[model samples]
Target: MVSAQPHRVGAELWGQLEPNAGLIILEGSSRKYPYIDAEALVWGGAGATQLGSSDNDATFEALVMTIKVRDPRGVSDTRLGRFMLSTGAVRAMHIDGGHLMLRARSKTHFEVFGGVPVDGNIEGRKYDWMVGGRVSQGLGNKGMIGASYYNRFNAGQRSAAEAGGAAALRGASWVDPSAKISWELVNPGLAEVLGTISAQTASRVIRGELYVTKRSPTRMLQSTSLFTVLGDPGTLAAGGNLRWRAAPRLDLWVNGALQDAQDDFGWSGYLRGVLRLDDDGKGSILGELRRQQVATSSWTGLRLASVIPLYEDHDTTVGLMPEFEIIFPDHPEPNQGNVWPWGRLALRWQPTKSWAVAAAVEASANQIERYDVRALARVSYQGQWPKK
Candidate 1:
């Protein structure tokens, strides 16, 4: 057995090890300038690298260095530095840049941002810069409607350009249902739309979401990618998900999706259920069944997992969990059987809100190997000041 331990390399650095994987992360976040409206975040690994780097070029993988300032009265917010973008006008991306958001007393808001595009592939995508913006107007007291624009460039050549509109409604009342239709529309040329509704009655709660997505590699992918070679066939996909809390401690979820690509429709979906054994919800059992039909293959998968409290020492709490999964491929794999199986047993301990340690043994049989087994351990910690 390997002694997988957690180490503190610095005041705010945390590290964890597991046989073939190692991570040393440095992170810190704080509020300053009268202490509430100014903030900066730093997160990276060992020489400030990534979580797990096995390639030479990834020695110093990536880092997040950003500072943010907000107006005390909520008039404006600004940020500068290197960070990852969230799901917005375009796909989420890591870049170096600046952002500004302004709110007017008239219930109007505006956002503008510009930066450089970045990813894992080194020396790829001769990207020089990118910029985007959004503007929205509030509708009475329920929701808001907005539109956005985004564009990217490759040195001297424009790589992509897209535009879209969006509208949202929450706590909607039947008296005014005008703003509740066709939720979001972004980049209709290669756009996406999503909307969700929820209802609750006593011990049961239900939520449903519908989405549509369209993508074209010719306009979205980098020029150097093989996707450009395939031209712009485009893809349209629709999917829906339903989540229900049937009881105080039981939950069920179902999801189904269909994709339109290359003159055909492909389908995929899954059903999952979970039950809690205790009121605190620390112990639970879960099972899931999935059916996947893609362009290249079709298969059915099953998964079962459970966790239960085992031992407690002083302030520390320990638990045991066993998980199993298997997949049945319609056809035999290359030199392998038609079935693949995997299992794992884990023991975990949590002594405080900031620290957790887990040791696990996993065994599997797949096309890559007839039978492979491994034992591993991991430790993690998080710290916060002025605990609020």
Candidate 2:
């Protein structure tokens, strides 16, 4: 598990277990401000079987519990938490009984869920908990599908105007599934194509995604396409990245697309690469080259990076990393001679499995470069949950 703060919730990895089961719970600050926050996760069922012969087996169940609240630093805040369990390979269920607050990037803002706060300011806070179910299946070696539904809630019995908006906490939002097929030829040739399409009536939105990749003796590349139709007047559309490694530690790539909903057709791509010297054991030097084309402009960039790890005792280790980058405008404009340089320093200490912590800081700059400071500290207690 990794988190920004001691009390902050984050992600969890169960390692590479052929058939293992466990539960994980996370809580963290989304907005990291006065109040508004969010939490999200991927989980499995509890006390599930590994497809032996019994449906009551308890060895293969995986569960996830996540809850986020407002005013994490204050008293009397709202909370949201849910537990999902895996009953079998093709069968699983979840119970949603916690409060929730959801927010998106820059578009659709503010979704109040599960037990609204009494502050009366709908901008933040949530009300009511919704329950739902989800089912998923894997197809052959390149396809998967999933579908789910849940119910919504409210503060209390109220008139239509005071009842807030419609809660989409229940019912099947949409069925989502995707497939990818690949073919490999000898050691020098390979090709793959993938696609996905989803439409939801509750939100009145339709989405489509496509991806393709091809590799040959001397070069390899991949690209993606995305299109979204919102019930509203606007639509969202874009594409993915394309990268090619021309030589050892050398790469070139470009990415961009149109987001009609935002009235923007922005795209930018670059050429970047890294090189390592004396890679056997001592140290190494790295370099990069890049060029980018946006909706209305073109630019070029470069990067230089290096790292070294020093060892003394068998129990302790230290490393240092530094990098620098510069960008030049295609058609020399005002403040066009822009350059950015960034660097990081890290220290690690691991006395035992029960204790370990790493500290790091980074700084960078642009044309009007400003040195920003950041730090991280971690502490934990480990006894091997399964004691393997």
Per-model C-alpha RMSD: 7.3, 20.1
Tens-digit lDDT track for model 1 on 1-388?
Answer: 2222232221233233222433444444444321122223333333322345443322433356666676656788787777776424455778888788899999889989888866533564555687888888887678778777777676556665666666665564422222111111122244344444444444337766666666564655655455666666767777888889888889999999898777677999999999999887889999999998867668999999999888766678999999999999877767897789999999998898678888888988887777878676667677665454
Prediction 2 global C-alpha lDDT: 0.39
**Whole-model lDDT per candidate:** 0.66, 0.39
TM-score of each: 0.77, 0.41
Q: Give a tens-digit lDDT track for model 2, residues 149-225.
A: 23323333220111111111112345444333223222122332333333334433223333222212111111110
Deviation (Å) of 70 in candidate 2: 29
The ten-residue window of minimal lDDT in model 1 covers 176-185
